[model samples]
Target: MRNLRITLIFSIIILTISCKNKEVKSENKNSNIGQFRFIISDTLAYGKNLARISEYNRKLKENESSVIAVIIENELEDGSTKIDTFSDGLKTPFFGISKYQTGKHKIEIKVEEKMMRTKKLPNDSLSLEIKDIYYTYKFHVFIKDKVYISELNEILSKQMDIEYNENPI
Candidate 1:
């Protein structure tokens, strides 16, 4: 009977060590960001121009839906232009000058979504602009809904530069 008890105790110790090791490995895996991709395309370009930006989220949930905001700007040579913003699942009207020279214009899209629950009121805002080209776009995602704003102001002053350039496209 004594020998059987010793064997049982040894088995229990080994099992406990194995379980702890497995848990440590699982935690390490969770610490790394999972893979994800965001597709951005110029749907109105008639298959001529396109761009895309992608990012990975470490804590992204498997069954969560993400909100995306897109903006397109048309720049003219004579120091004038138009701006447009579109949401992920909405259609936007194609508006632009009929015959305008197309140069190295700027196209920017800002996407923001809540990754985790927050107690404070959510006021997330992201804006993108190309100054020399005279174009800009802004997108804000809140807990309740999302907003898209387009403006043609002169190259954003230095103060607003941080907000526009730091946002993840």
Candidate 2:
């Protein structure tokens, strides 16, 4: 009888701990102090642009909770605007959009702060570096005269602290 009672107590403690952990995890997923967006500049032709957009959009839709619609707006020499897009939906309450191009380019981040609030960090290693990591709500990238809107939802950034200018020289 004593052994059974001890086992029952242990089981109750374990179940309580697990329930608390699950609650914390769900809360963290929705907590956000603010959001940001990325502006990248590159130069790619229309065909190349289309291919990149298709591949990136496919990957984002498959991976993330939010689906991004990539809008390609080209400013013609005659002052007419040409626009092309992939996917369809309203862009709001988005998880994030990624950077479209690789290598050197001018990239700017604009953070829209919600409200300042202090919160404890997660014990996981990834959460330790979350502040340095910027999450983009929607991306508006300019490759030459063509503007790619929310073309991607992932950025392959090697270093978080680094910045690139339009012209280094």
Give the 10-residue window scoring lowest on summed lDDT in candidate 2. Answer: 18-27
lDDT of each: 0.28, 0.27
Residue 162 lDDT in candidate 2: 28
Clashes of each: 0, 4
Residue-wise C-alpha lDDT for candidate 1, range 45-89, written one tens digit per residue: 211222222343435333222233334564444646655443322
> TM-scores, in order shown?
0.26, 0.20
Model 2 residue 89 lDDT score: 26
Clash pairs (backbone) in predicted model 2: 97-153, 98-152, 98-153, 98-154
| Candidate 1 local lDDT, residue 16 | 26
**Predicted candidate 2 versus true structure: per-residue lDDT over 1-169, tens digit per residue:** 4433433343333322211111111111222322212223233322232222212211222112222333344444454645533332222212222223333333222221111112235783111110111122222334432353324322322111122232221
